[model samples]
Target: MGRYFRRKLLIYGVTFVIAVSINFAVPRLMPGDPVARMLSRNKVANPESSEAMRAYFDNVFGFDVPLWQQYLNYWAALFKGDLGVSVYAFPASVSSVIAGALPYTLALLLPAILLSWIVGNSLGAMAARNKWLDNGVLPVGYVFTAVPYMWLAILLAWVAGVILGWFPVAGGYSFALTPTFSWVFIVDLVHHWFLPFLSLFIVALGGWAIGMRNLVIYELESDYANYLQALGAPRRLVRRYAFRNAMLPQITGLAVALGMVVGGALVTEVVFAYPGLGSLLLSAINNQDFFLLQGILLFIVIGVLVFNFLADVVYVLVDPRTRLGLEGGQS
Candidate 1:
């Protein structure tokens, strides 16, 4: 077990280093100069002033240094939790910019992924046994899963939010409400949050249901299930055992789904004009804010790695094969 953990830890450590290297290289590889991008967004008229301004910006952003030194400085700042200043939201630290956007994304994504998994799995497990449900759910699930998330979000926004006038189509909250702890502000926040959340929920639901349905059916036909039935176990008991074993893979699927959920939520946020990491990422890209982009991507990498680690732990607890492999030192 200790060796298993050590191997996992070493692999994760290597992954982290590679992720950081890629994060740093990505912005530098982007076309156009960050300094020029920043300058273009300003109104400096004089060529001499512009030149001087550009030189100063270059030095401040460490573009004046050799590439090796700049890379070294980047690592130094990273260790100190300094992600540098944002070129887009100038003078703001990358941490603060990301901080402001992170919560909205967490709120939008976490629930959407979890709820969809729970509901989808339940429906799928049911469909596997019930022919009537299979006929109804399979087709609808296919259709729902087939729709692109952004288009579904737009359709929801137009139908429920625009035409029906039941909800706000955009933003995290109403413009008039100051972000207070009062009931009115909280209600307003939920009103705006629902459409995007629902869009994500509906889209993710179909795939889980379909996968769970197929897995459950397969597990029911497996040798263990046949043995249970041959031993004269009740139908309910056999079905319960089959569903429990089938869910092992479904749990792994949920972990994989989480990695996609973050990006999906961000895209949905952009569609809804919600002030979240997705919108922040767009701002970082448009202005070539390398530090900010690096910070955001780093956050995502960390989140995915952490969730994967947790999934490994959960798998070990639930799946006997995983623990046996660990004991055998299967690396």
Candidate 2:
């Protein structure tokens, strides 16, 4: 267990370094200057002639420094928790910008992820049990899963928000209510959250359903499952022992999925105009807000790494053979 934890921590550390490097390198590799992008957004006379702008951009963006020095500075800032200021939302730190938008993302994503787990897994298990259900569900699920998430969001928005008028068309909350930390605020928040949740829920559920059903089916054929059947084990025992073990991979997938829920729903958030990290990321990219973009990407990378590490630990626990292998000798 000690060695296993050490291995996990070492992997995470290596992953973190790679993530940070990519966060810095990818933007620099892309065409166009960050400074120019920032200047373009401003309405200024003789935008190219300002010495102050030149100095600020050169110094802050490291345009004046050696490439290696700039890379070192970038790594230094990570230690200092200085993600730099947003080019668009100028003077505001990227961290603060992300913090402001995270609530809406959580509000939008939490229910969607939860509902997907409950409904999708249940549907998958039922389908796995019934041959007819398996035949019908696999095709329908494949169709839904194959559909682009943004298209689904739009289709649902029009049908539910416009035609039925059951949910809001766009935005995180009503413009009328001032954001506060009171009961009235919470109620308004939930009311506003409904539409985005429904949209994401519909789109996100398919993968889990298909994954779970396949897992359950595969487990049903295992030697232990056959043994249980021969022993006339209770149906519940057969499922709990055999099918549950089969579903371990899906649970690991769920952990990865949950980690991504924080950062991967950018398109959905953009379509809905919901104020979240996803929307923030979209705006940052379009406007070339490099600092904010880097911060968001780093956040996502770290989140995924942490979740993956957790999944590895869970994987070992679920299958003791994994732990035995990691211990470097036969059990």
Candidate 3:
């Protein structure tokens, strides 16, 4: 077990290194000068003196800093947890910018994700039990999954917020309500959170429903299920037997999905103007906030890595055959 864990750790370390390196390279390799974009809003160039303006442009866009030096500086700052200052959102550290916006996304998304899994899984179990339910739900689930989330958000916003006037159209809250920690603030916050949460649920629930449905359907066809049927097992026992076993495979996907909560949905956030990590990322990129972009990417990479590893560990726990296979492969 120790050796297995050590091997997993080593692999994760290597993957993390590669992911960070790639993250740095992508922004650096882009055509336009990121530094210039970063400074464009802040630096006002006077056209009166072409020479002075030219010099300013050169200083911002034509710097000949060695790639190695820039890479070294980036790594050093990352280690120190200083992702540099953003030129776009003046004087705000990339870390601070992300920290400020993360909670709103989490508050809305975390609940939606949890509910999707629970409700979807239950619905799937029901569908698996009743063929009529499976026939009814699967097509609807697939149709929703096929539709783009941004479009769904738009539709929902129009129907629920515009025509019905049940939800807020945009932003995290009503402008009238100050964000105090009082009951009034809390009530307003929940009221505001409803639309984003609804958007997230509409987008996420379809996939969960389909995935759980497929897993349950496949489990129902297994030999164990047949044997249980022959033995006249109670309905609950049959369901428990099939679901418990089939859930092992589905667990890995669910774990990885949960891990991606930090990444946020860029299109959905943009459509709703939701103050989440996804919106932060879009703003950072538009303004060429390199440090902020890199920080968010690193956070995402680390999250995916940790979650994937946890999934593997869960795989081992759920299916002893997996550990046996790993042992045999190692030998």
lDDT of 1 by residue, 177-204 (tens): 8998999999998889899889999998
Estimate every model's Cα lDDT from 0 to 1: 0.88, 0.79, 0.76
The best-first sequence of candidates by lDDT reads: 1, 2, 3
Q: CA lDDT of 252 in candidate 2?
A: 77
Best by lDDT: 1
Positional deviation of 130 in candidate 2, in angstroms?
3.2
User: lDDT per residue, candidate 3, 240-265, as tens digits?
Assistant: 87777767766776766666865546
Residue 120 lDDT (model 1): 96
User: Better model by TM-score, 2 or 3?
Assistant: 2
- Global Cα RMSD, each model: 1.8, 2.4, 3.3
Candidate 2 error regions (>4 Å): 46-49, 131-136, 262-264, 323-331
Q: What's the number of clashes in each of the models? A: 0, 0, 0
- By TM-score, is 1 or 2 better? 1
Model 2: weakest 10-residue lDDT segment is 39-48
The global Cα lDDT (0 to 1) of model 1 is 0.88
Query: What's model 2's overall lDDT?
Result: 0.79
Instruction: List model 2 lDDT by residue over 201-290, tens digit each.
Output: 766678778988888878888888889899999877887765567667777777777778655478787888889988888788877777
Q: Candidates' TM-scores? A: 0.95, 0.91, 0.87
Predicted model with the maximum TM-score: 1
